[model samples]
Structure formats: C-alpha cells, structure tokens
Target: MGERTKKQKLILGIQHTLAMFGATVLVPALTGLNTSITLFCAGLGTLLFHWVTKKKVPVFLGSSFAFMAGIMAIIGDSRMGDPDFMEKLASVKGALIIAGLVYVLFAGLIKIFGYEKVNKLLPPIVTGPIIIVIGLRLSGTAINSAFYYNGEFSLKSVLVTVVILTVVICVSIFAKGIFNLMPILFAIIAGYLVCLPLGFCDFTAVREAHFLSFMDKDIVAQLLCIPQFKLDAILAIAPIALVTMIEHVGDITTNGAVVGKNFMVDPGVHRTILGDGLATALAGLLGGPANTTYGENTGVLAVTKVYDPSVIRIAAVFAMILGIFGKFGGFITSIPSPVTGGISIVLYGMISAVGVRILINSRLNFGNSRNLLVAAIILVLGIGCDSIPVYGAVTISGLALAAVVGIILAFILPEGDDSVLN
Candidate 1:
C-alpha cells in the first residue's frame, strides 16, 4: 500500500477525534469524573493498545460502558450517607487496577486454550442480547430528557425529541461521506439549535466560565493522586476484570473486521489485552475512567475508509495536551444536560440494536430452552436488579451487573451446537 498523504492523515485524525468527542466526555460527565483526564487516558490507552498490537488495526480507546454501573453504585452509596464513600471509590479504583491485570490472565488463557475455546463461551447469542438490553435500558433516560418532566410530561417536548431523533437516525443511515460519519454530532447540534427557540438551554454557566480556565480542579487534583491505597478496595473491583476481558475480545474482533485484519491472530489477542489492561490500570490510578475500544470511532472508520492507526495516536496526543490545561475541560463540562440527553436517546438505542444484531447474525435458536433461559435471565437481572447488594457496603448496577450475570450463565449452562465458546 502507498503511504498516506499528510492531509489524509490529518483528516483521519480529526475524524477519529470527532467520533470520540461525545462518548469520551459522556463517561466523565455521567460519573462526575474529570473529562480532561478521561480524554487523556483514552488517547493514551489507544496508543498503548496500538503499540502492543504492533500498530496493525485502527482502533481508538474510549471510556468503557461496563464500569458505568460500578461508578453509579459508588456514587449512590455515598449519597446514602455512607461515611466511607471516598474509601469505597478508592476501593473501586483499586479493583479496576486489578481488573486491568486480569486481562493479562485471560489473554494467557486464550493463548494456552486457543481462541475458539473462549469464543465458544461467549458467542454473539449471549453478547448481542446483552448489548441490546444495555441500549434499551438507557433509552428511557434519553426520552425523559428530550421531553421535560415538570412532574408532568409535555407533548410538545416529546414531539420535538422524536423529530430530533428521527433526523439523527435518517442522516446516519442515509447520508454519504462525512455526513454519514457524524450523524450523532450533527443530530445533537440540530436538536440543541431547535431547542434554543423553545428556551430549553441555559448558557449562564458558559458566560460565567473563564475562557482559558481548567474545568474541574478537584478532579484534576484527584487524577494527580487522591485516593490512597487499601487492599479491600483492590479486591472489590478486581472481579470486574473477568467480564471486561471478554469485552476486550469482542472489541478486538469487531475492530479487526472494520480494518479487514485478524487482530486476534496477527498482533495477537494476548498483547492487545495486555495493552488495554495496562492502560486501564494506569487510568484508574490517576482517577480516570476505565478504557475500552470505542464502537463509535469504528463506525467512523467504516464511513471514512481511513484505516491508518497513526491517526488515533495523533488524537491521543491532542487529548494529552488538552489534559494539561483546564479551560477546555470547563467548556465541555458546561454542555447542557438536555442536549446530552437528546443525543443519548439515539446512541443508547443504537447500542441495543447492535446487541440484537449480534444475536440475529449468529443465527441462534431463540426457541431453545437453554438460549431463552440464558437471555431472559441476563436481561432481567441486569436491567431489573441493577442494584444488587454486595457485602452490605456497595451495590452494582447497569452494564456491570448485566455482564456478570451473562458470564455466570454462560459458564453454568450447557452449550448448544451454535455456542460461540465451545
């Protein structure tokens, strides 16, 4: 292949950055973490992943949705007057640190046992449905935000939201070139623009904000190291590593398909997992969110036909540079909740659709008792019992619960002919 032109490389870099823009900020916004630090770590994580994988596949790392539950649970517990909320947060970080290490362990397992053995356990049948449920679960939040609820829902707001979402979906599916790649970003801008006439957004925060000030000082300090070490905290979060390891496999596979290369075999799954794990641990140590390969950026890659991994490295460099300063962070933090909510409705629904697609593409028999039971149990428990009591100190919610339940059922149930793990 011929070398990429400088302009092509620059375009690729910008596309990757824009693709990850909403998602990279969403994690920190939702979890009350440092947006700048999260972006910094995400970029760093992607670079590290590329390095370990020999720079073969073009994948950008971003915040993992898997840890959303853990973060919410910790924050919720803290709200309930748990005197050890900070301690619990520290422990959660510690667990993630260990979880990152677990990737190395799973990677070794794959090497020893072979990829098929692991694949047999987590076929699209299992993963697809879980992904769907995850999206559907968050859809409610999006819809609610689009239509203001002042103790009563507004029909006008709901109609407006539907229009916004429809426009986004249409553009994503039908638009060509750059338009197709940025459906979400465009949708958000359009939706917020429409809402401007409705008096739904407030720019007061932006006006009060300094043009060149860092966003969240507290988060930045914490990223510099605030939560001290405790063994219990490490143990609490480590179990999540088991599920995220599987997620890493799925991400690599998906990325490989996008780039038309077998990342699992070429750069080798073990090395890729190691890179992800280490980057995640480093992010956690510095009070940033856990990292994962972003599907949004993958969609951009698909749309742009740019397969260069170096573009992601450039994006990462940009993220690190942004992290050093604070004003950019403040600006992102100042984004209106309703605007985020409007976009999230579509993003979350797409996530669910991806899950359904996974199962459909796998051609799994839903009629089978084993398949039905596994899917039913995982969906309900994950979305239903989102909050599970753990040692009378913390609770689990959202993706973390869904993931754990899915893995447990996959392990316990008998594998059918279509099993991905067998």
Candidate 2:
C-alpha cells in the first residue's frame, strides 16, 4: 500500500470509508444526534488523531458503540418525534466531553506507567468479556431495530434483514482475497436495493434535502452545547472512557499485528491514546457521539493488507465531504431501519465472537476458578443489570462498572497457575 500509485490509494480510501459507513452512521441514528455533524467530526477527529500521533498509524477514528448505553441513559429516546431531543443530546455531549478528558487521564497513566502494567491490570480475561458484553448487551436493540415497523413487527423487515445478513455472511466466509474485505459495503448496497422495491425507504427526504449545508443545518441551534454542565451525566458517562481505552489498546495491538508492526510500542501507546482522546473530545464538543479506534476499519486493514496511513487519511477526508453536504447526510439518515437491523445482527454478533476469540487466543483457562469467577461476574454484572448503587440515590453503571469489577477481581484473585491469561 505504501508504494501504491495515488489513484490506488484513493480507491482503497473509498473502500475504507465504505467499511466504516454502516456502524458509524448507526450511532447518530440510534442516539438521535446530527448525522452530518457526526461524519464531519469523525473526519476532523481522524485528522486530529493523526496529528497527535505524528501520523504514523493507519487507524481511522469513528463513532463508538461502547458509549451507546450512557448516551441512551442521558438523551437517547427517539420517541415523540423527540420534542426535547436536542436538549437531551446537548447534555449527553457535555458528558461525552468529560469522558474524552477521562481518556486523556488514562493516556497519561499509560505514558507514565507503561503498557506492561496496563496489560497486566486489564489482561484478556477482563477486557475480553467486557468486549463480549458490549456486543451482547446491544443485541436486543439490533433485533428490535430490524423488526420494528410502526410499533409492530413486519415480515417484510425480517425478509430484508435475513437477505442482507445472508449476503454479508456468505461474502465473509466464501469470498477470496481482497473480495472478502468488503462484505459489509457490498451487503449494504444489496440490501438498500432490496429495500427500495419493498417501500422500506423514503427517497423524498433525499430530494428535499439541501445540496450544501454547514454543520448539518442550524435546526438545532438552541440545542448546541455552550458548555452545559451536568455532574450526573459526568458520573454516568465519564468512566466508560477507560473501558474504551482498553479497547483502544486492543485495536492498536490488532492493527499492528496485522500490518506486521507493533504500533503500541512504535508510535507509542500514549500517543495513540492521546490522539483518540482528543478526537473523542472534538466529537463531544460538537454534539456528536464519542470517537474511538474503529475496529471495523481495522478489520478492513487486516483483510486488505493495506498498511499505508494515506488511505485512512483519505477516508477521513471523504467523511468530511459527506458531512459538509447536507443531502448526503440526509440520505444516510433515511436508510431504512431494517437495513440497519440486518447489519447490526452480524456486527454485534461478530463483536461477541471477538471476545470469545480473545479468550481462546489468550488461553484463559476456564477450569481455573479465578478465571471463571472473574469472567462470569463481568458478564452477569454487565448484561444482567444496568448499574449498581454506589451512593445514596447515585449509581455506577454500564461498561464502566463492569470493567472496574473485572479488573479488581483479576488483580485480587490468586492465579492457580500464577499466569497472565496468555
């Protein structure tokens, strides 16, 4: 990829954009945030990430699914046409900004203490289940979104989802070489075409949408946060930054492994974390969801064997172009609900499967009581309950609590083999 012609880099960049499209837009769609702004922020954020890290890594930053629960808890309702939606969204943005700061704190800790300590503290036993929980916990939303039709299940959506799912899965398993790298993009094209004939999508919004608009329009002028502060929102959401930080390490580790370099050590983990943190803060400040090292884009890098950072930066530029054009954003927002559902089914499941892979790859001995207890507790704590009461009328919940619990258990419990999962 590094030696490719300029035209080839652009083509690969477009492919990377397509890989990130489904999951990236889904965050704004679910949280009722401005879709165009999200895209714009993602682009700007990626550029910022590159600058912060001295432009060494090829990772593309995008919307993070890990913070969905916190966003939902704060301002996530998509009902009543969302009369107060922006008000709720603005508040969430405030929390997300703080969360980004928390990410910086973790980055500093990593910089000072080094990766080995963080790795020992987190280990695959803790982080793997947390990843699985992040995916499995969102399963209900994925299914419900696919089947939902004016408050009723539709056989139409089911057929559509199934078709798309099948296409994606088949391409994933059977496609050879570079072809396997683009199943999501191909499947989406196939599904959207299927949706058009079935009357699942509305083209009217696209037609009515403006060709050019700044920041996704001035519609939410009042809702834009000028530093709206909420301690509760901070407490609810900020800690999850740490959870995503662990994920950042894994994502970078995976990217490095695939590209045949140790990004965690070369560009330095601290630099990468700093880049991600600043990018996320930019998203938060702009009333969008938090940003993270997108695993989907990393997957594309792995499959395509494109180690060049130029392609990802190009993809980031593409995202910004879509963001500045209101019409492109509108079309993406209006993608039929069920089409998203189909993608989510595969995506969320793949996430959980990655967790299982983490365990298998790490060789975490389930027969060992310590490993069993830690993993089991993290799952139940993460999926079974949303939060735990930590103070009078206050609670710690979501991935933050789940991750903290897992880390504590992993640290305190005795290892029968006196081993670190791997």
Candidate 3:
C-alpha cells in the first residue's frame, strides 16, 4: 500500500480504535478498575511500546484477560469487609507493578539466554491448561453476574443475559466484515436496550457526569494513596506474567506474519516484551488493568491492509482522548453487571477454548501418561485450590501456583516415545 493522506490515516485510526474498544474497556468494567485509566494506560502503553521497539512494529497494547483472576484474588470480596476496599485495591496495584517487573525480568532473561531456553520452561503442555484455568476459574463470577440482581436471584436478569448471549452468538457467527469482529459491542447494545424496559438500566450516573472531566474524584483519591506491596498479593499476581509473556510472543509473531516483517528479528522479541512490561507497570502505577498486545487491532490490520505504525499511534491518541471524556466514562461504568456478565460468558469460554486449541495445534499426546498427568494436575490445582498457604501471611494458589507446579512436572517427567503425537 502507498502512503495515505492524513484524512485516510485518521479514519483508519478510528477504525482500529473501534476494533479494540469493546474488549479493552470490558477488562476494567469487570475488574472494578477505572475505565478512563485503562484507556489512558492502553494508549500510553502502545506509544511506549512503539518507542521501545523503535517504531518498527505495528501493535497496540490493551487490558489483558490473563490477569483477571489474579487481580480479583488480590482484591478479594469487598463484601467480607476485612481489609477496606481501597486497601485491597492498592494491594492489587502493587502486585501488578511487581507482575510487570516479572515481565521485565523475563525480557532481560530472553535477551541473555535467547527465547529458546525460556520457551522450553513453558511449553504448550504447561501453558495450555494454565490458560484454560484462567478462564474456567472466573466462570462463577460470570454466572453470578448473569443470574443475580442486588444480591438476589432474578428471572429478569436471566432473560437479559440470554438476550446478550444470543445476540453475541448470532453476530459472531453470521455478521460480515467488521461487524463479525464486534460481537461483544453489539451484544452490549442489545442487552442495554433490553434492560431499559425491565428497569434494569440506571442512567443516574450518566446524567450527573460532566462532559469533559479527565478523572473522577474517587479515582483521583485512589491514585493518591501509596500502592501497598503485600507479599501474598505479589505472589498471587506476579507469576501470571509467565503466562502472558508467552502470549506476547504469540501476538508479536502473529502481527509479524500479517505485516510480512520479522519483528522478532528487527525490533527483537526482547524489545517488544520490554515495551509490554513497561506498559503494564505503568498501568499498575496508574491504577489500571495490566496491558498486553491486542490481537484485535492486528485483525484490523489484516482487514484494512494498512500496516503503518503511525496509524496505530493515531488510534492510541484517540483512545487517550476518549478516556478523558467524563460522560463517556460514566456511560460505560453505568452498564449493568448482568449485561457485562453475559458478554463474559462468551469471552471466558473463548479463553479456555484458546487453551484447548494450543494443545490441539501442538498435537500433544494425551494418550501418553506423562502428558495426561501434567494437564490433569494443572487443571485440578488451578481450579480446585482457592488458596494454598505457604508462610504466615503468604500463599501460592490458582493459576500462578498451577503454572509453577506444571513447569516443575514438565521438567521432572521423563519424555516417553508417545509424549507427543507424530
């Protein structure tokens, strides 16, 4: 493609922004993080990633689904009322900052040892189930969100969820062009409309919201506190980087293939990983969700055949602009939990499905006892154990613990003839 005019670039940038919008904001909506901050961090992170990569790769960074379980664990159930909610939230931010550092640590390791050694440590067998666990672990939250209203069972909530899911399923399967990639967005719209008649929708926040405030006062207060670095929370959140780092590799590789550029060799995987780490850490510092390379924008690249880094930068700018609009933030935050819950059902399932795809694509032999043991252990430990106590106040549990155990088992279990299918 030839160089395009500014008008063309601006339009393409908006298209890319649209492509990433639904999923990016959804992370904050689900996690109780600020939507504006998530958008700001995502935009800032993309720009930072581009600068780190010398502007060679065409990529956008957005909120990561991988860290959702870990983040929620750190935040804990506010209803319990043990640690104050803001304190718990501060711990989450602290842990995520450390998690981002874990990525930075891996980036340094990859730069020194090469990606191959790190690759062996987290092979498909270990990672696939871990990814599955990330999704399946959150399934309850999705269910509760779908079925409950004001902490009570509501048939009306169920109806709303069904409408959202039905719309999502239909759009994803039957819609053409960009619409095919936007099932969640369409579902939210449908769900919101359905909710209005049933008195499930709330417009009070939207009505009270300013037209152009950058940050809400409550969010500003949260940012003002020092981030608490609890050892247990750090252990919970940091190990997740092991999984997302591998995901970063896949996303970069996919983007490279789409653009016909060897980004791994040019900007180098280490550089890309560093950019991601910095972006994620920035998010943690700013009280936003962790950042990851967005595959959605790459899909836009494939569809539009526009591979320019500058256009991606333009989209990042647009995202930042959107973040500061107070009315927009209120509108998103006002979306009913059940509506987002319905969207989560599909999204969370897809996370697990991605894990299954990884195993299938690698042709890992489940018939082999070693392979079976590794996967079974990861699935059980990850999903079964809510928290396993380690020391006085610390524990290793969930995906982080599962990943650690799986990696050890992968190394310990001797490879048999049928370890992987031929």
Candidate 4:
C-alpha cells in the first residue's frame, strides 16, 4: 500500500466511525444506559485496546450485546420514576466492573497456562451454542418492540419499523463500497426520516439539548455516585465474561484474517483481552455498558483493505469528539422504539448467524450424542431458564447459565466418532 494523504486518511477514519456508530449507540439505547457515556467509553476503550496490544491490532471496541440481558435484569425499568433508580444503576455498573475484572483474570491465566487450555474449556460446540442463545434470548424482546408500542399495536410504529427493516436489508444486499458496510447506520437514517413524516418521533429532548456540552448533566449525575457492589447483580452479570471472552478471541482472529496478519500471535491474545478488560472496567466506573471488539469495524477493514492502526485510532478520536455533543446524544436517545426494534431484528439475527457460522466452520457432528446433548442443553438453559437461584439473592441465568453448563458438559462428555447426520 502507498502512503495516503491527510484527506484520504480523514475520509477513511470517518467511514470507520460511521460503521461502528449504529451498533455502539444501539446498545445504550436498548439498555437504558447513557448514549454519551457509551460513546466516550467505546472510543476510550478502543484506544486502550490498541495501546495494550502495542498498537498492532486494528480493531474498535463498542458496547457489547452479550451483556444487554444482564444489564436489563439488574437495572429494570430505568425510565420508571423509582427513587432508587440511581442505586440500581450503580449496582449494575458494579456487576459490569466485576465482569471486566474476570476478563483480566482470564487474560492472566491465558498468559500463564496458554490460550490452548482455555480453548479446551470453551470449544466451538460449547461457545457457539452459547452465542446462539445470547441472540435468541433477545429475539422476543426485539419482535415485541417492533410490532407494538407500550404493549399496544400501532400502525404508525409498524410502518416506520417496516421501512427501517427494508432499508437495512436492501443496503446489506445491494449497496456498493463503504455504503454496503453500513446497513445499520443507513437503517437508522432511513428510520429517522420515516418517523418524521409519520409522527412517530418526539424531538423535544433534541431541541432542548446544547450543541457543545462536554460536562453534561447526565455525566455529572452518574459521576456523583460510586458503583455499588451488590452481590446479586454481580452474580447475575459477572459470569457472562466467559461467553464474551471467547467472542473477543473470535473477533481478533477475524480481524487478523482480514488484515493478513496474526494479531493473536503478535501482540498476543492475552494483551488484547487485557486491553478489553481494562477498557470495560473503566466504562463500568463511568456508568456505561461493557465494551467488546466490534465486527462492524473489522468488516470495514476488509472492504477498504486499510490495515493501518492509525486509521482506527483516528476513528476512535472521532467517536470521543462526538460523545461531547449533547444534541447528538439527545437525538440518539429520542429515536422511536420501533425503529430501534427493527434494526435490532437484523442485529440479533446476525449475532446468532455468527454463532451458526462458527459451528459450520468447525463442522461439529450433531449425530454425535455428546455434541447434540451439549448444544441442546445450552439452548434450553439459555432461552428457557430465566434465572437459576444460587443463594439468598444471587442467581445465574440466561447466557451465563448456558455458558457455565456448556463448559462443564464439554469437559465431562465423551466424544464418540460419528458421521455428520442431517
């Protein structure tokens, strides 16, 4: 590759930012976390990840969907006028902080025992199904939000949602170049425009928001309280690191494949995980969601064929700059639920599809009773069981439950050689 001009670099950076913007903001929008803080953490986390990996890995960190369930479970109904809402939010952050520390702990173990051992504990059959469960668990919520508004069906909401979903599908299938890599952003724009004419949007918050407010009230308010380390919330949310940790490795490997370099061998997987861990911890402290490696940005890397870490850093800086714009945050939060829901349908399905791809790539034989049992148990536990009570208040459920059980089954079950049976 030849040396690029400043203008070229700027455009590339902006393209990368747009690629990540939709999914990053969507997490906070869904989980009732602050959009501004999520953006700031994503940028900060990406920078932190790059620094820890010695600036060798070209990747961006964004709000993770894997933890959205835990977040919602811990901090239910954030819009409700509960006097203790802040306290509940603090507990959620505390749990997320623990989850980040777990990543660091795993990173340390990987450094000592090697990633091979960790892989043995979380093979494709185990990790892949757990991932599928994560997406499926959210499927009902996505559908309900898309088809209804506050438990009632609305024609306007459905119309806007259909338009957004159609735009996302068309862009994903038909758009060319950089635009093809940004279905989510295009869907959001299309949704916003559609909502405007249909009377589905309320722009009051955006109208009242300041153009350039760095120290916004939301940030200030979140900063005032220390994160609460409640045992129940911690137990519910922290164990999810097992699932996302595997995802981090997958993302890094995919990014390396795109860039034609082995990031896992160079900067090392441990360092990358450490970077992700520390970034997520910082986010929890600042009242934001957990951070994970973003595949969207990696897709951009593949399309543009620009593997420069500097370009990714430039995108990170753009994210942080946008985080300070109060109006941008307001506008994002004000998006109609149906539009968000429509985009989520594709997003959630894509997540499950990634898991399916993992299984397909591994070519796991479902005819083998061990493999079938492991996957079936994980699917049922993840989607069917809401929470498994462990103690007085603490419980393990959802993705965390499936992840824990899958690892155990993977260890104990004996693999019998069987042909792939359809």
Tens-place lDDT per residue, model 4, 198-301, is 77788897897778645666667775558999988987788877767866775776566557676776888899999999999989998889999976665556
Off by over 4 Å in 3: 1-35, 50-102, 215-269, 284-319, 389-395
Across 1-422, the per-residue lDDT of candidate 2 in tens digits comes to 12667776677687677667767888877877767778888999999999888888998888987777677777745532557765666677788888888878878988898977866786778878887776687688779878886679999988888888888778778987556656666777787898898898887768866787563335346235475668877776777776677667767765665576767777788889989988988888887789988766655654455778978999999888877787876676567878777777776676676677777877777878899899999999889887565533334556656778898999998888745454
Q: What is the C-alpha RMSD of each candidate to the true structure, in Å?
A: 5.0, 4.2, 5.7, 4.7
Give the RMSD in angstroms, all C-alphas superposed, for model 4: 4.7
What are the Cα lDDT values of the candidates? 0.66, 0.76, 0.78, 0.78
In the range 309-361, model 3's lDDT, one tens digit per residue, is 99899989988877778676567667787886776676666656667767887
Clashing residue pairs in all predictions, respectively, total 16, 0, 0, 0
Error of 1 at 286 (Å): 2.7
Higher-lDDT candidate among 1 and 2? 2
lDDT (C-alpha) at residue 5 in model 2: 71
TM-score of 4: 0.76
2 against 3, candidate with superior TM-score? 2
